[model samples]
Target: MGSPPWAADPAPASRLPATNLLTIEYPGYIRDTSDSLDRALVSLSPVAGPRVDAASSAYALAHLTSLLERGGRVVECRLPSGSGVPDAMDLYKHPILGDVTPSDHVVVRVHRQVWKRMVNGQEERRKHYRIEVLGASSTCIRFRRMADYAFRPEMPAHASEHPTMKLHKILEEMDVAAMHAHRFMPEQEDYYDGQGAQRRSNLAMIPPPFFNRQELPFYYGYRQNPTSSLQTVTFASTSKRSRRTARKGDADLLDAGNDHAEVTRYLNRARWRNMAPVAVKFTEDGPVPTEPDAMLAQMALSERQLAYLERLKKHLSERPVWSRLSLLNQFSVADARALVQTKELFALVAYTFADGPWRDALVRFGYDPRQDMASRFFQRIHLRGKAPRAPTTRGAFKAEYGQASASGKAAPAVGDAQARPATHLFDGQHSTFSTSTFQLCDITAPVLLPLIHAEGPSDLRSAPDITTGWYSMSAWEAIRSSVSKSFHALLSEAGPHKTSEEAIESSEGSGAGDSSEEDE
Candidate 1:
């Protein structure tokens, strides 16, 4: 097959430009999550992509062989761990902690046999299900039972001016019950009207431009007339001198560069864009699905006497941690939320193709996914616009409602930027930070690609608009360059247009045909 035009290595394009480095900082109540184990693990180069640590579960099903002074051995469940990385957490064990061996302070190695056996265990059974299906797994049904216990949005009775703290209090009290939702789906604008498009859009194949969210000011807060975001940073894989500094197995960083362009605006400092977004939920062509009521049945915010899914912050908070993590049953949720916000803020940036700072960060810190890499970086963030808040009153809230707050607001949104962010999240000397350079395209594309390529949900391709032409690199253009020269190259190279209007069946009773029209 002809080379996949859109495919590019995620690194510098062999040449070095000294002007690429940039320092971006922001001002506002920002919550950073690299400190948390769960989030920190996402930054690691392990797993399918960045994901929740295998060990960061509601319970760590460790098998303990404890021996008392009497020389009797007993086993029991260990307290669930909050640490995020499965690899790091895999190191510490109660036996190791309780070891009476002479090399007490040493980081003794656990046998691979023992380690595998310890982390090994079946997931929780779906006892939480409303009803058990003969073939359904336990994990499948528990959300129905556990919904009441997850985080619900929390709104305070009295209005508060601190934005960060208010968000912190609100999230802490909310129940973000878990769901088995398929995350990011790419727009297949890059597809070269060939078998790929005919069989499935695989969204990534379609070509489009990126949206500069700063264009819309709500997420940016008070920022305005921000500097143009430096555009695509191309990385070369075989630079003689570049290899001088290349890591042992480093690949081209260009693809990562392209992907970041789609996501960086969300991470750009809010001071540049000046906006605010109230809620986040996950959705599709229609409205976002209501969370399972079971997960919403119990929540931490409800215990605080606050209303559910409520936002009471009118100002930034002095305490960043509180705004981020105090609310979730698992540390992963809070960490994921914080990363999403940071990414959204970065998205606001408008990059100029000539010199992209976003590219520089990747260069300094490579984003290649190696299982052994200690410090990995993840730029993917998901967000969605929430429905308008329903009218609410403090008086209507019921004491026994079982919801975090009884305000009756609509559910918050989840994003697909897998839509990534902006904001000062904090005040600093500069609105941005200077970090290692990267292969932006590689980072963004490879992650979503599975959804964009061979096996992604087909519908995921057509609906979401990736705004490809707007991107400076036009990685799509580069990809298309490999495919053909013209905008309608596929029409010329493959065959005639053969407009589907002539082929589509017009039977009036065909609901499936009507749905296809809706998709179109």
Candidate 2:
């Protein structure tokens, strides 16, 4: 009934200032699915946003077909079973390639219907043709096709053509150009009362900021600061002119502007000022629930592995860290361990809003349901943090890690220690990467809803301090989808306070309810 808080104010008549563009590149691949004859080669690229990739692939195939037809070759086109778009592998087919010995030639099976002179002057006989389109580099496409009706063979001497060289070059260009035009969810904004004080706060949102590893020294703050971990990036979309220029098989016709839409950061923001408060499990005042065994089961860990994880749990549970900072609890332990085991990390995250017309918006944008676009925003979260700035010089590595040799005695610092993975695995004594891994969990709020992690069975033997946070299914229903009062009280208590030096000193000295002091 009303405008959502996240909606941006309409742009004025004047244009906004120019912003730098970010070119996000993704790898491409080819899949063969000739198992059912329904599909042969499916051109795939992980670059397009949501459904755009599939559509672009189909258009590319159509263009390839047109280029072949223009060469004055006998070409028979086969439509897919339904209203589905053209497939890359099914563009053309023939019957003769089945008999031809595999050789170094661009073999094509095409069809032509010719009128018969002996049988009947008006009757037409379909003939199968095999043409090998050769390229300058000896590369060839074994093109094949079947005629509408079986009749006789035409151009039986394995005809050869050379247009494939141009086709190959054209296809390469299309793949490269594919990177230039793409789309993604735009940034979102919302208003919030600053920590229970009766005023709104400004916040920006991005989904799935990390796809490989987390970068340490990166800050997770409301505004970009020296400590902020997330950086700004741009997602370019096809310009209106480019859309008009998109013609089948012609890469050069694509619009050059690649219209710049909204700019977004690499992370989502929680607007409440009191977000850092450490929560208790199953308590009315905290985020977790009363029963959490089911949640823990999802991690699928053995007792021994769970026991090892306890060290991390204990470290995170310490006073100031729990209250003032965010860390991975139980729900994320299995995922965390997996990251370490694989030496790679990726967590898929989706953008969520308190309440909005998200489904309708996704539909309007032509996103497929499976694209997870209806989730509003989708991102692959990478958890590994970049190694801290390489210690400035060679000695710095020794200074950072302390121990230089395997023997009991000290060894001379020679090469760069930072280059070693072992250097990043631990702190002076403890596992700093493990600790930082927990920190990453907090930064990326996996649970988008309001509910927090609840308590679990006492028999469980993993981390004593590490408890996972999840949405309280029962509590959520009991409240009739309303937020718990304890949350509101938290905001009231955590509201922004006086920032004058005198007030700040007094608050710091008191240390009664100050979560920030936990860091110190």
TM-score of each: 0.13, 0.17
Backbone clash pairs in model 1 (N, Cα, C under 3 Å; residues 3+ apart or in different chains), count: 152
User: Which tens-of-lDDT digit does each residue in 235-316 have in candidate 2?
Assistant: 3333344344344444433434533433323332432111111122222222222222232324455665565455444543
Query: Which 10-residue window in model 1 sums to the lowest lDDT?
Result: 138-147
Cα-based lDDT at residue 113, candidate 1 = 24
Residue by residue across 408-506, what tens digits does model 1's lDDT show? 556433231121121212111111111111121222222223321322232222222222212223332333222112111212123322322221221
RMSD of each: 42.2, 32.7
User: Over 4 Å off in model 1, which ranges?
Assistant: 1-287, 300-308, 312-429, 434-463, 466-520
CA lDDT of every candidate:
0.24, 0.29
